[model samples]
Target: MEVVNRYLETQASMCFSILYDRYAGKIFGKCLVLLKDEALAQDATQEIFTKIFLNLSGFGEKAKFSTWVYSITYNFCIDFLRRRKKMQSLFDDDTEVERLKDVADDVADEELMEMETAHLRAVLDRLPADDRTVLLMKYQDDMSIKDIASMLDKTESAIKMKLKRAKEKAYRFKQEMFTEAVL
Candidate 1:
């Protein structure tokens, strides 16, 4: 673990290779959740690892090393979503989402949960970065409400309201999608 940090500090290519070996699938699973495109997720996975390598010194081990790395991956995918301003895919099935939480990327569950997730990803992408970020940090990254509020430099109540509003928008988008689908 420390060696991964050292490799980034030294910018050694071989060390980076080792780091990639250690975390590539983990990063890819994260990307798939955020970006939802196998190809772009693959690219985003690589790009995130590259960014981590390039900026590892900035990582001061303030959080669990994994959390810090995940924060970077999450932020990168959100940025990619914002730039694209589109939602072309639903996430992997719910089992996959849970499996993604594990180290092995195993998908033991196979049921798709459309209601559980809605068509809001694109709409969420359309939100201001601040609003979008709060939701991703809360829902996608599973950050505590207090932690998210602190990270956003806001109060806990404010973060809750933002999450509520974000949920409303996602629900609205789901309704819209349903209407379109029915038609």
Candidate 2:
């Protein structure tokens, strides 16, 4: 936070660069996991950083920097998906959904804990963007529930409920995949 404060005070490129260096990869990975498209993720990463850079002055020190950054990332990705869905509705048919079903059926999770990283990401991708965000924040970023509630602007109980539902959905998806594989 001292570095962040210095960056805010100095408006130095080096300070901003240091912040970017510390967070860009994690932000990009989160975008990729949520967007499920490398090209879109790359674009989204750039957009997220731009948001972070522009909004740095507004940061109130209420949450960890990483949590703040991730909140932006998650919000941007969800908005992007919503926009994409609206656009898709104008042109897309059921083929995309059918293709996703095929992909899901081909991937099985004997045990989620034992699943490979790629498989885990695939399963995560199958979840709703909000659910995926919760899981990522909890497990991938190891953020606490209180921090998540703050980031999401939700009550702690709401965050907990969301997390529980996300986990249950992931487990159900895994079981469905496993059953598909068996058949």
Candidate 3:
């Protein structure tokens, strides 16, 4: 996309705006799945876009453009989490906890999946960040293991192992939650 490259080379902020309009929601969706907080994910999205704009000069046609952007978004979020020194990068604070609980309280809420997803996110948050990230890159983003491994600088087999372990943890969390409810 010459236009995209021009947008970068010229520092045409509006051109970048068009690019943002094209993919902000998808990027935000990925961020939400990774961070599990609306606000934090929103912030991460902004940061990712900023990084994209600044680093556009470095990007090449070696891979699909979408894949390149996805790689940037993934790395940006992971860096944010690491820089913050958070035990879990899922939520920035307890407000998200309150918000999710409130949504579950609403009787007419149509998207029960949100609650389930959030619950699953909480379980995911308990996992080591590396394991959680690999699972998200695989399941949430539909990334190939090779792509995911490259993004994370890990081997494909290692990504597979991490994915397997993450799945088991998620399953165990589900079983424990279900058992507690029954008890």
Off by over 4 Å in 3: 6-15, 87-119, 179-183
How close is every model to the real structure, measured as TM-score?
A: 0.54, 0.76, 0.70
- 1-183, model 1: which lDDT tens digit per residue? 677666756867787777777789878866665565699988888788778876777878767777778777766776677578653231211222211122232211111124444445555545444445665676556788887766545688877766655555555555556657888
Question: Among all windows of ten consecutive residues in candidate 1, which has the lowest summed lDDT?
Answer: 90-99
Q: lDDT score of model 3?
A: 0.70
Worst 10 residues of 2 by lDDT: 90-99
Model 3 — TM-score against the truth?
0.70
Q: Give the best candidate by lDDT.
A: 2
lDDT of 3 by residue, 4-38 (tens): 88796787878877888987998998787667789
The positional error of residue 162 in candidate 1, measured at the CA in angstroms, is 4.4
- Give the lDDT ranking, best first: 2, 3, 1
Scored against the true structure, residue 80 in model 3 reaches a CA lDDT of 74
Residues 1-183, model 2: lDDT tens digits: 888899889999899889989999999999998888899888999999999988898999987888888889988887787788833432112233222333334222244557667667767978777778888888888889988877777889888767766666676677677657878
Error of 2 at 86 (Å): 6.2
